[model samples]
Target: MPSFSGNEVTNEQIDELRDAFERYDLDSNGTLSAHEVRLALISVGYEITEAELYDLIHSVALYDLIHSVAVRDEDRLDLKKFIRMMAPRMVHVDSDQSLLRTFNMIDRDRDGYVTVQDVRAIMVVLGEVVTDDDIKDICQAVDMDGDGRISLRDFIGFMHSPI
Candidate 1:
């Protein structure tokens, strides 16, 4: 877990942020410019407007200054910095109905559980160029019981897990 401003963030959130960062690091440069960051957040279903993005980053920059942490470089953010910036924002999506909606979207088969196949299919349909291993890793991250399938209970727990 990582802590920022006295707030702890879980490993699962960090992992998801890392994945988004990697996906949107279009140049494979291990960093995301503001434009890339916007795309990444939108990909993950965060409908942030440009104004909101600017405001969030400005606040994050102030936090960085106070904490002596360099979260950006020439308008680009690396994986670690991106995780630190996103973890708190991610926590607000933990409402039960929102989580249920997200779970249902991923559980394409409507089988009461989310499996690798469902995730992979969704990625494909979304035109995301993710590898098979990436899909497996995503599923494994939320499969709290190591069962390779995520039930609604597991989904809720993952969404609301204490940082």
Candidate 2:
């Protein structure tokens, strides 16, 4: 699963989130109502009911509640609040099995490590024009242990890291 930490939220990630928020802010009011939030989540592949959304907000401690009440149509989330709520959930969206599948695909030789050659070959197969330098740069970024290759652990960490 993705392993993003609270402190690891990057500018690029926040920018992407801002873009999403703008997309769902239909009224252009700089906020999302419950319905808009629901649509945004659904667009991002989360299937949530209204009650589930409210429950999740409370359980996740997304906001400071002065008092408790039933869900209301006026309930809304500003960009900052939405980001607070989404960051934690984003880390848990991918399961271990899904990560494994992606790792396996990247580890083309089944050697339990992803070398630059493997990544380059995959990129070529996918019709991506990447130079050897590009591959090296990617490997350098992903190889946490500095061993010139990405083990499953490194791959997982790379997947988990905020862009």
Judged by TM-score, which candidate is best?
1
lDDT of 1 by residue, 1-163 (tens): 6776567777766666776687779899988878788867754557566788777667667777887976546367777667767877776554466567767877888989988888788676555688888888878887888887989898777655543
In model 1, the clashing pairs are none
Clashing pairs in 2: none
Error in Å for residue 68 of model 2: 36
**TM-score on alpha carbons, each prediction:** 0.53, 0.44
Instruction: Name the lDDT of candidate 2.
Output: 0.67
Model 1 accuracy (lDDT, Cα)? 0.73
Question: Candidate 1, which segments miss by more than 4 Å at Cα?
Answer: 70-74, 92-163
Each prediction's whole-model lDDT (CA)? 0.73, 0.67
**Model 2 clash tally, residue pairs:** 0
Could you give me the TM-score of model 1 versus the true structure?
A: 0.53
